[model samples]
Target: MTASSPTKQQDTNHFDPSAPPPFKVADIRAAIPDHCWIKNPYRSLSYVLRDILVILSLTFIAVVFKTSLWLWPVYWVAQGTMFWAVFVLGHDCGHGSFSDNPNLNSIMGHILHSSILVPFHGWRISHRTHHQNHGHVENDESWVPLSEKTYTALDAPTKLLRFKVPLPLFAYPLYLWKRSPGKSGSHFNPYSDMFAPNERRYIVTSTLCWTLMVANLIYLSTVIGPTLLFKLYIVPYLIFVMWLDFVTYLHHHGHEQKLPWYRGKEWSYLRGGLTTVDRDYGIFNNINHDIGTHVIHHLFPQIPHYRLVEATNAAKPVLGKYYREPKKSGPIPLHLIDNLVRSIKQDHYVSDAGDIVYYQTDYRMVGKKVE
Candidate 1:
């Protein structure tokens, strides 16, 4: 379809949250071939093994070349990207896309996610909230903007910290500790608002696993010098946080045009899901497990990551007006820095009253003179 075509334009250029979706969710699902939905346990396991082997090889190289702290920069980038891929696999497992067996899924999810310091069940439960309310302003789980009133209520230091570059990138660890403002929950705390009472045992188990991983890291730090441990573990872990923050924020926020956030009668599963943007990180696409193919994943989280690209391609015709083509990127996705900066500057808050809301810039908050 031409870029200007009405159907294509709706996907790329317009999202009217107050309006109902043009097509039924069933239509889009039907367009994706049945094979795209199949979960191949062996194939899923292969990806998990591949990422692990790559991580191990990178670690081995870093250790063998210990004297060359110069190589740490390269190690950080490679290992950090691989950690993101590991999280994606755990994410699939949480959705039961890794296999048919629930027990196996839970075991694999904990191993992959907790090893990276994420509480698996904790993240999974909250992420389930995100999936269920992808574009609802009041209820969306992550990266939803504050209302103007709330934005103004934040202290100057808090405002600066949130929009400042590099600072927001490090927010994942804190977010896992305490959720976004106006929400109260630690992914690590089962009693927090993110999870149900019945789910506390799973949350406790994942939190314990995360604690054990931290303890193991402390032991390794003592065995190896703290400096070396920081170089090996801490640096890569921070980079992983950057990847998580960058990817999650871009998926929901950095489009050239504002995506609508809905409320009340305006919201529906299909409508809310369409607000998610797909992104392209060029070569990192496969290494990151097709996570940038996000629109389809938001629509059908149970479809395995390996199959998202195929499913997205197959569903596009049916999703005609809902799928925005991702902005192209080079291997490093440096181009996204502009998108992020622009969004952070202009996309500050939405009006509390609108059923369909768009972000409004608060010039006073940013100390900018608006023309």
Candidate 2:
């Protein structure tokens, strides 16, 4: 079928599709493996507290203590890793994946995601929607795709900058302001996309709370000599943004693995996720909170990150060839290449059905052309 054709059928054989899976709801009540569920609330609390302590230990040394003069590398790397863990906790809170209680989730989510400068409920709502529509180009809340015409409309110069320069140069800074208040997207408003602007009460309240927190930190920075704030807080937060862009980009944007689309309301969860790749990143898996198991996460987000691997292992038989894990070990340059390739392809769903295919036509005359 051509790009604009209204065909409702697709080449199912061209992609690995599965029955809607991970079956988290069905799996939730199943006998969880020992130590999997964290039945003890104290243990859950300790895990969170431990992450905090590690963060503080590293950050204090780097910013305040400054004692072990040779410890700067250890300080920065350790603090950055802990921040990643903290982000995982915040993510769990948003999913209510860390605890059985909603109130606890809300409070923890505010503390974690807000401290990192994201609007808690606003992102939670979008991220939750992302889980629901993970693979659907138009519907996936976060990594939603762009159309070919839309992709092609970019002039050559703009494309060059987007791939060759801007992605590395200004992407992280852009994410901060983009996710901040009153930007192109909803300004910290969860209901903004789905409801009337007047319905964003929770958003406004939480945003004010975050603003106050930032203000208090800024004030403390003066007494602490601004050095602590910049050394510990500001630099780490920027690193978090860098991680965020990398994680989100390589997950779905540019993998050559899978592409599936449906017309109108015919969308199926199985086909939407076929393109996910199993990135072989070694042990950095824990650092990214096993976001590598993105396929299972999208299938059943309620499954906590800690339990995701087990869930994937158990369901792989059922998911069969459809299963995908993000290729974890690809170097930054490989990732950059992969991303550029995906960005310009059929980045979004097309009206017609065919294979999950990618092709680029170069019109510049480099050699004799075949008729």
Candidate 3:
């Protein structure tokens, strides 16, 4: 029952992730330097401006080389990564890490997210839910595993699409429209169960912003011709979705060691937050604004993205074995592709019974029989 006590089904390993951490959240907080917690508006704004300039530059280059087949694919990958970077900045705003000013956060969050066709407030609120309930089997929002019963109930086509590799990479758009399987509510719908009565107004505003962005895209597509628009915007947008899904999923799943999900008395904010894993994205460690430094961010989201590395390093001694050191990447993160594919094939669901559970492989999905 205590933080140091082992659970009923204890792993004989030296460290048990399911056991509550020996340190408290305050312990980690005290470890991080005070400056890491400070949010500077000017510095945050510079990132937004830089991302906007890069996006515009990419767009300009793509337009100039519109006729070149080779450049089109290159443009999609670069532009999409930039779009994901923009979303990370907006995500900081959602967590109040962008600055201390609410108005400034809202203004920037809307502009960045809307341009990428995301409902800013809707996603912010839902993401807040995800943070608050992370590692809770029933409550956590993004990439939470399905319960065994729920997984078995799913039809073959649904199972294949959900568990399949490339298909799952393209799931972000569908998730925005309808959240992960076994959950309901559109991120854009104010009346959906996801929001409270007072929160509906914010949802309505973001949904309208999202709609306006879509309308603007339609108008531009007509003006520039659909094919050109598809090459420039649509391809990049899809690629951005892939990056979003890929990064988000990897943060919670695909650890070499399995992570625990909690229910009932086993769940605590600190315990759930500890389940999050940091990643090394090699060159992208900076390009995507250090989102790969995620464990500390989940534990203390108010820490600016610029300072996550410092915060994590400071907290590491206290974190001890709980901190999973990320595998180093080469010039590119091609190594992560293996993690993604292996996790999809293996981490299909959790047991219905335990207060604490790890993902159970559905052997059938991987062409194996339960031994």
Candidate 4:
């Protein structure tokens, strides 16, 4: 019933693919204390304000200390970390866990998400899709692996692109623009296949806000000069992309075992949600509002971020053998880099057709695809 350690052998791993988990969703939900479910608007907004204040403070210090080129590295890390925290708060809004009022969540979601160049409604809808289909092969949004047939069908360039590090790490912006492989439609486009007709207006509103943010940056560049703007925003924005890609990719992809992807009747909301692994960001557990408590967040997105840890502790007994213990981490999660590299090297694709499937590596395709 204990969580498995990182060093455990893959064959000895606890998850049994042949049978469905014994526990039911309601059982786990009932295990959590009632108080953990309450979402306090004031408490949520306090996090928003805290991240904004720190972000602005970092920017001000970097701008005034511009002559000290040496400090730019420190500024970039601090600012980028704060940017990720802001995104997490906005993420809470998208899930409707920030407050009881829909209007306030919308307004705050737009302000926080758009500032970071995310199209709020666009991302919200797709993210909701991700949550719904997390363990399904074809249906999962974001970081689902390719099937062997799909991988072989990809052009040489794309096959290569899929496994490379820095390139994949920077894929967030491109994903927002076009989405993942085998998926069509843009997060920026309301008419894209991912959205419904009624949802188009929300997508357009978010897109315009993103446009305005771009325009503001353009104007700022004209006044402050490109160098300062680059130092202040562009560099940090790329870092934010790295942070986003790093945290999310590991959540579902880099476990010791090749995590199963479900299909057809085998899939269920609780099963899909359990496929996600919790992570430890050490001190960053609070700085980013406990986002690394991902297993519980996936199980119950309605629980506010601040309450995820409490809910997670309460649910662990119920989760028992089902929970995948995260590898412990330092201030930064450097340990995961090994998991990431190993996955990229070996976990290339799953079988094309199966109710349950594990990743399959193409030995010939491995070295050839990473260049």
The per-model lDDT (C-alpha) reads: 0.85, 0.57, 0.90, 0.85
Candidate 4, residues 268-300, lDDT tens digits: the string is 888788788888888888898889899889878
By the lDDT metric, which is better: model 3 or model 4?
Answer: 3
- Cα deviation at 239, candidate 4, in Å, is 0.5
TM-score of each: 0.94, 0.74, 0.96, 0.94
- Stronger candidate by lDDT (2 vs 3): 3
List model 1 lDDT by residue over 1-371, tens digit each. 01111223346645543356678889889999898888999999999999999999999999999888689899999888888889989999999989888998999999999999999999998899999998998899888778777887888777777888868888888889988876787998878878899999999999999999999999999898899889888889889989999999999984756677878777888989988999999888999899999998999998988889999999988876567788786677787888887787777778867777777778876688422
Predictions ranked by TM-score, top down? 3, 4, 1, 2
* CA deviation > 4 Å runs, candidate 2: 1-41, 64-74, 152-162, 165-184, 189-191, 194-199, 254-258, 261-266, 278-280, 325-371
lDDT of 3 by residue, 1-371 (tens): 32223433344556688877889999999999999999999999999889889989999999998888899989999999999999999999899999999999999999999999999999999999999999899999999889999999999988878889899999888888999899999998999999999999999999999999999999998899999999889999999999999999999994767788889899999999999989999987787999999999999999999999999999999999899999986878798999998888888998888888878878767889522
Any residue pairs clashing in model 4, and if so which?
A: none
Top-TM-score candidate index: 3
Steric collisions counted per model = 0, 13, 0, 0
- What's the CA error at residue 248 for candidate 1, in Å? 0.4
lDDT of model 1 at position 50: 94
Q: How much is 167 displaced in model 3, in angstroms?
A: 0.7
Compared to the true structure, candidate 3 yields what TM-score?
A: 0.96
Which ranges of candidate 1 are over 4 A from the true structure? 1-18, 369-371
